[model samples]
Target: MLYSYAGHILVIDLTTGNIEKQELNEDYARQYVGGRGLGARYLYDLLKPGIDALSPDNILIMMTGPFTATGIYACQKYEWVTKSPLTNIYLCNNTGGSFGVRLKESGYDGIIIKGASNTPKYILIDGDNVDLQDASSVWGKKVSETQRAIYEMTKADTIVCTGSSADLPNPVKFAGVYDGHRCSGRGGLGAVFGSKNLKAIAVMKPNKKIEPKIYNPSGLKDELSELIKDIKKNEVTGEQLPKFGSIIWMDTTAQFGILPTRNYQDILTYEDIEGKIDTTGYGKKVVKSKELKAINCLDCPILSGHVVIPDHGEWAGKPTKGPEFETSWALGANLGIIDFGHIISANKECNEYGIDTISTGVAIGFAMECRQKGLINDDILEWGNSESVIKMIGKIANREGWLGDTLADGVRSASEKIGNGSNSFALHVKGLEVPAYDPRGVWGMALTYATSIRGACHLKSWTVAAENSKDYIPVSTEKKAKLVKDIQDLRSVMDSLIVCFFAGRAINKDWIVRLVNVVTDFDWTPEKLDEIGARIYDLERMISVREGITSKDDLLPHRIMEEPLNNGQWKGKKITKENMEIMLREYYKLRNWDENGIPKRSV
Candidate 1:
């Protein structure tokens, strides 16, 4: 029987040493296109409702999409999905690296990994061949080091392996690790891998060149040409992003007086916004004035990377991926340290350590707030001390010392333990920490933060697109529900298409359909195709609802509600609880969700 381009999703049941490829029917692919959408569907199907998140029975899928490796926008992306050990809900982490491209070249769109291995093993895939190899020697290294050693062992194959051993004997044996540029860093997917006795998964390119599985449109070349031109003309994707990446937004976010300062105690912009911020937070500033080159992901041209900062702090002129606007805001203003160089240094170190810099920064910022309020000693933050901050990240990752052990629980759980009203300033929504944009100044973010499915994620649907930009009307609560819902569906479609968020202008629905139809032979409309996005988003929300998330869980920290911005452009602005309730109720109605933020069954 002929299958679509995706064909059978390779299923490897490591428990009984059984391996088989299961056909991916049209129904599965239609509702959940690929990557996150596909991963969500597969995991939700197999993972029993309310199962322990770290159980071997919990299915883990590493999936890609039809657009992967098609020379399209950001096609070099993949998703590692499972029930999150951290949040105990649908945890799908999307990473943009060469793994998916290699997998696609190996003639497969996705793989499902279930059951546990009896010993440390690595899943090696070269086209259709699969090998579960012994990984005893590779178990105890840091994440990046693990990647290098795995490559050497596998003869230069691209590897996605968990970093360091589970060190299963440690306090948080679940501190599982992995390597590659972008990571599924939020949820403990790595730990779930460790739980299964799986160390690494290397997707190798096949030696035998495989032909394309479906028909390619004769018009693909011309369509690509127009897309490139459209991308070149877009301002953020073209001009501003090229120079500053997301770093340019720092001063802008600061100007709004809502940049998550001092763990939400002060919405005030730091005095150091200009003095402490620099260009290195954007990409490889190693060459100095020799034309700074930004490190972009996959097929993106937005140049979200930054050059290195000159010697100022612990990391003096080290080349790195970034201290994007989110990292800078959480690590800098949120902590009251404005030294751009210092913040960049911390951000780089966190990435290198293979931890989520946003979470780490916010976690540390939470710790600092604890210190200021006398919950912990002041020695941890040590005024204007960048090295201490770096040291703190190391300790937290390793779960060392008292403060580090507490912080390893992350900001929310950690603050709750300290029990001194520290919970009020933790500034986290559902254990996962909040991102840069302060919801206080941008009232729309209040709903965005409170209702985001991924627990305070900005990317899920960055309403700031409508709030901050001149093209959008700010502070009008009327159309926000429709606005965020549309953008979210757009984001979902992009995730499935595996395209960058910047490609809406260039890669329109027709182009997307062409990319999909040509790749898989399914002639889907832009509207119908976009509906798949809505379905994926709804499914994700449904997973949360099943995991016990509801309207009561939808909340901004009490500090954001009661506290006011003491300084900067929009001083004294605050989000009132009454207005917060009004905003979310509207959003729920728009999303076809009940007042309690649960998806309405009638829809």
Candidate 2:
């Protein structure tokens, strides 16, 4: 009997409206673990290279880890894997909500969706009853509305639905969650769903709990208690997170010279400007004045997500989940907008429209830079204009005319289309825009952004914590490659286990091993899991390599490498070409790859 997993896979073809259930491959599970790792392996096995990412040929897999629905801290997360419609490469995005837990309880390990429907539809999984129903009734609605409608129609406990943005002629690169404020908000997966004519996926909680077998329930309980205790004890996860939320890093980033301000043309050097948007500044001006409260995911120990409500002004009395560090940086500092109220409103608008805040913010930043450089003559878009930022959110979601359509295509595609040296300023890696972390200030991120399979993703290897914390691993080229590789491998393990990275920060590898042992039949050690991580990373890289990504493509934008920070304590700091070459050579060597970053045949 399978332990800690449902041991079944569901397949739905939108073209024929057929459903198929298949047994999980134990060998794949053992090698790749689950979640991110399992998703990568399955994609590699199922797909060939060079298919149109928006075409029916492209596949999407929704996967959960062994720890999902097991009452473990941060196990409520699940991941979506697909060839990105934005990047045309492999992509994996995770979201936190009750959908994953309900999915597992419904007795399926994961679901693979393929083919495009002749018309718009939504998937309904009510215990054994699964069907593709017409979505025309709800297709054009906003995220919250679509979710509410789906819940009302299906009475499902959990739902993942696309926003109206997905139905646009040029769908924006993100989508929202209906179950909670969670979102699968990256790599334009929502646009892929739109391309496939899928509106939403609604899941009902299992009538009866189908608990995965556990070897030692009592021991597992004790381990869980210890983990919870450890989390509560950790200052960052327990105190700081619950108190300030993820935006706590705004102050740190500002100090470290990593905060991307004014489209990254300058770092946070001005005290007055920094003080306006920094954590304390925001707390006083926004949260305190508005009386917004903090909220956590279901059973989440660290309440990193907070509800934002403004007491006065345009967005007064409106509530939204967050403008996390990245969101705040992208829409706030990057745009030169310091009003916390405006930032909060923009965050809410982005969520409602089912847009990826990072991508949308970057797209806007790119547009502002382009306009500044006379590359485009967009009157509606200007740097530091919060009003314009808020308006563009709706325009982009609806694909309103040239500006909206162009922005919806993402920074890389948009820049390439409107070239007059725009690509030089377009901040992206492998077609995906970079997140808020400025790689120049945090040197390790250069390698992280360059080599990440999902293109300029921070979560793939979040080494910034090491750089900022007392880990002693300085953000330098000398040690960054090894540091990045190690973190990537470790994160691979965590992602497979489906533990939130925040929780992983508090728990150690040994604790994770114990959790696995108590829940699964396999006796996995730290060393074994580390090997699995390496395998997972290698497999994901291989998929990209197969898609024709070369060492040349494994690079950051010229702005990050060539242009030095003009201001701040990190003035003149940039990842020089030589520095990147050294780091890449070392990183490839450590990964057993050739000079061109192709994995050796033995690997």
Candidate 3:
């Protein structure tokens, strides 16, 4: 008996229209655990080096962990693993929705999708029955429309689909896959879907649900009780997040002078735009509507998602999902716009079109900066132009006009195409756009962004909270290398467990190890878990290395390193090249990687 696992993997080859069930490898299950770690293990063994991410040979794995659908708090996430069409390297994007739970209940730990269908198709997993069905009827539809249509046709409990952005004549490289509002929102996995001529995946609720047999139900119950208490008592997971969603960080980021503005040309202070774009501002402008409310994933304690009805805009009175802190910053403050309604509308469009909000915002911000510098000759791509931002969203989604088509390829490729020193401020690390947090104010994030395997992702090693806490100095580079390395390893474990990142406050290493021990009957210590995390992260790095990534790729953008903040507490501060090198050297040494950022220990 496999405790806390479905004991099988569903393999689908779209080209051959074949479906096969392979027994889950018990040894791999124990070694890699599940989700990101397991997916990476499989991908490393199956994928050849230097294969085009959009080719039929590229594989996509949607994996659920042991804790998934086990009634564990915040264990609702599943990972989507593949070579990113945007970054051309290893990508592991995770999301929380009913889809993962339903997928698990359908009796498969994960689904490995390979080969390409000659025509549009959708995968239907209805209990024991699985088939590849023609998707010509819904190929060009938006995400929500395709989801609704698929649900209507099959009564699927959960459906994840790519929107029209992925189906465009020239698909947006930053396109994402959506399960309602929850998204695998980074790394252009949706473009990969479009390349395969795959539109959506629908999983129907099983007639007889497959629940993982817990090794110690009573012990698991006690641990869960403690976890719940921790969650309810902790200030972040308990009060702030639940009350303000992710927008609460707006106040913190602004107060700390880390609020990225005008494509990171400047950082905003609290006094600059306090009640306009901060938490209080969001509450007044966006959350005031009675139709707007906080929502949560399955068994999650923190209600971080907001469904809002904008008071004014084209989307007014329409109950659409609101933007998180990252999205708000990307679409609002980053572009020099503060109108909450416009930001909301922009976020809604991005979601509907199945594009990454972060990448889209940064791409537009890059264009706006380019226009200011006379590199781009377009008047519409100007800073603080909310209407223009909306217009560009449509253009980018459809690959409309020159500006739209160029920006659709992401800032890195866009800068290369429209060169005039634009690459200096592209604001990306390893081809992926940096998230809301400006590493200038939080020095630890400098290392975080530079070394993250999937590119400038905050979740991989979120040093912000720790660096922002009272115990640590936020601007100092001292000890940041160790801090980043430790956090990265821990996050690798969390992603493998498929636990929600927001729950990190309550669920520490001790708590996680306890949960795993009870559920899977594994006698894992905190040290052991840390080792496994390091191993998983190393394997992922190896995959990237095999694809030609070197120490040169592990770098911060020129803007982040060269340009200093002009205002606020962090004035004249920038993550210098010297600082980045010191951190990188220390990080590489910690990971047992060579000077070239290649793993020294063979997997």
Best by TM-score: 3
User: Please, what is the TM-score per model?
Assistant: 0.91, 0.96, 0.98
Candidate 2 local lDDT, 1-603, one digit each (tens): 668898888899999889988898889898888899998889998887999887889998988999998888877788888898888888988778778888888988899998999899999997778899889999888888898888888898888887888887556765534445777888888888888999999888778877777767888898888888888999988898877777777877776777777777877744645567777766664343232322356678787777668553455786666568788888888898877777888887787788888888888899899889888787867877888898888788878878888888899989889998989889999988898788887889999999998999999888777876675444477688888999899888888878887777787788889899998877988899888888999998888888998799989999999999898777788898999999999999999888889888442
lDDT of 3 by residue, 1-603 (tens): 679998999999999999999999888888888999999999998888999998899999999999998989989889989999899999999887778889888899999999999999999999889999899999999987898899999998888899999987567999999876788889899999999999999998899998888999999898888889999899989998877788988888887778989999888888876888777777765444443322357656787776667665566778776679999999999999987888888998898899999999999999999889888788777889998999999999999989899999899999999987889999898999999999999999999998898999999998877898877898887889899999999999899987888888889898898999999877899999989999999999999999999999998999889889887788899888888888889888888999999999877
Kindly report the root-mean-square deviation of model 2 from the true structure over all alpha carbons.
2.2
Candidate with maximal lDDT: 3
Query: Which runs of model 3 end up more than 4 angstroms from their true locations?
Result: 285-295, 311-313
What is the Å distance of residue 212 in model 3 from its true position?
Answer: 0.5
User: Against the hidden true structure, what lDDT does model 2 obtain?
Assistant: 0.82
Question: For model 2, where is the 10-residue window of minimal lDDT?
Answer: 286-295
Q: Write the per-residue lDDT of candidate 1 for residues 1-603, one digit (tens) a residue.
A: 222344657889889878776777667776688888887877777878788766778888888876777666646677777876666767767676677777777777788988988888888887778888888887655677777778888864567766542434332322434436555677666767878888788877679744345456555556667767767787766676767777767766766566656776665454445545634333334234432332445446655555566354545665555566777776666677766667777766665455676777788887776777778885748544677787887787677788877776677778778887877887777767788887777777777777776777787777765686775545446566667777777777777768765455456567778777666666778788767777888888887788888889888888777787776666677787887777788778767788778887521
State residue 538's C-alpha deviation in candidate 2, in Å.
0.7
RMSD of each: 3.1, 2.2, 1.6
Error of 2 at 392 (Å): 1.6
Comparing 2 and 3 on TM-score, the stronger one: 3
